[model samples]
Target: MANALCDTRHISYAGCVAQTFLFVFLMSAEYSVLTIMSYDRYVAICKPLHYGTLMDSRACATMAAAAWASGVLNALLHTANTFSLPFCQGNAVDQFFCEIPQILKLSCSNSYLREVGLIFCSVLVLFGCFVFIVVSYVQIFRAVLKMPSEQGRHKAFSTCLPHLAVVSLFVTTGFFANLRPPSISSPSLDLVVSFLYSVVPPTFNPIIYSMRNQELRDAVRKMMSWPHFSRHKLLFCLYI
Candidate 1:
């Protein structure tokens, strides 16, 4: 309510615009991406034999498109609900970011309608993806457990380990924060939750999946050797 405290009367249209853009972008990028990972596991586990055929480049692209559209639409509803109310008396916004509840707190309007709508939208979109991810992994976990070969189980879990960890962290922190009372949400708790939601997943994803892959490591070594060979007298002469 910086604007209100300073006696400015309304929420800045520009600020709302910026916040809407960020909310939409983050929803589409991070949250929807989690669905793709979940669907991928479904393909790999539920239809392993057909995964190659079912998830060809075009099919994967289409799935990604669908997920992006869903996330975008969901965010639109939330953003519209958030800014739809008129704020006449006060203009103090809450949170470091445009988190839904924070915006809800700032408005003077009877917030029940928007709050209910926000809860409904959040449950449908975020919790929906979360449920699918959980079910997909439960099946995957079962399948991995049932594999006759230890190697199979190890391989399956290894591929899923990073995603499973990321999903758990995101969902758990978010769920607790949303479920808990406002009085319970402190800066330290929010900071840790934010890190789990945003930073940890991006940091671990590539390194977890790609770094230890033998094929990639071998390609790197091969490329390095090729440069050395090219620098040798005969190879250099041939290159010249």
Candidate 2:
């Protein structure tokens, strides 16, 4: 925002470092939370009898704490490793934000190899989480399909599908943004991919969740019928 207002592209070194740290920390935490949410849906649908016991308040808190802790650790490692490298490729980052891969492009030292190795390990961990989510959903769908009542199945799908959609959007865009081939990469393509992964999911998550809520949907529908209210106004409200 400041850059746009001032018509300038430069960011202070400290500002860039801080941005990188916060961005990684928040994204990592969000992904971890999403993984935990998949487990939540799995328990709710696959093991309804054990849901209360398994997903008790204490367990949820513990999982939440672990997610944040992992994010902090990940941010610390990546941020420290990324900034420690010598930069001879100039300070200009190709992407809008101070992304790790973009920062890596500016390195003039072999030590960046260590960060690359760390990223590979992180990707493996993320892949494991992705696999877990997929397996959980598989079990959930199997259980849902076995339900004797159509209403029960509908309810289960309603609760789970929004979450699955959010996860899919998050994972696919993120994977492509970070792992796409260098051969096809261009500044325009990179910018769009980065925006899709970083901005779109968070922007749409609340709206997606709200759309699943009967009460909220009804309220929005009613509001839309008001003479004073417009579609743009409702959209602004949703975005807020």
Candidate 3:
């Protein structure tokens, strides 16, 4: 993007294609990771006895690898279908990024139908993951309710709340951006929704998790204090 700006918005054909492919790939991978993280939490809170075994390091790595593979396949499918369309409407994209919804606007023919098919398939997969997350959380909530101690229930809710919030933001913005009717697709709306789907969750997730998590907060504090502690130790050493 900085290069685009520096070159006065002269994005090369290859750059455009790469940007669109990466946009879909990274977004899909991120949402998948969030879904997996939710399931990990569900196991930790609702099935504590088996959590360690179920989400061992090997399992975590496998799940992460699957998410990346799925994201790449989905992005390749969309990218191929998208570029196959003749851009009779011209090369101009109204948005800052090269997403399917905006790129489809420039198609010269109705050849975008193939891309729509891919979009439908993608939506189905995303909705399935959403449903899975919802079901997992439902089970988690039920278990939290049955906890004998109020503090235990509170801790569980605290841990789950950030994940739920991030998921809702991610799914809602993505749905609006991809699923909006063409008649209602104004530049302003597209820009706003694109920002939400593309930028918000990536920036927000870590902040939400770190600020809400006690362990993460403590680790951050320790990290921040290390330099000061070292400085003090050096002064004490000189005095000694």
Whole-model lDDT, model 1? 0.71
Off by over 4 Å in 2: 230-240
Distance from true location, Cα of 97 in model 1, Å: 1.9
Across 80-121, the per-residue lDDT of candidate 2 in tens digits comes to: 999999999998999898999899999999999999999999
Candidate 1 lDDT tens digits, 99-213: 6665666667796476576676666767777788888888888888888998888888777887777677667756776677878787678756665655565666686667558
* Clash list (residue pairs), candidate 2: none
lDDT against the true structure, each candidate: 0.71, 0.94, 0.88
Off-target runs (Cα >4 Å) in candidate 3 are: 3-7, 180-183, 213-240
Q: Per-residue lDDT of 113-179 in model 3, one digit per residue for the tens?
A: 8888879988899999999999999999999999999999999998888888889888888888777
Consecutive 10-residue window with the lowest summed lDDT within model 3: 1-10
Stronger candidate by lDDT (1 vs 3): 3
Candidate with best TM-score: 2
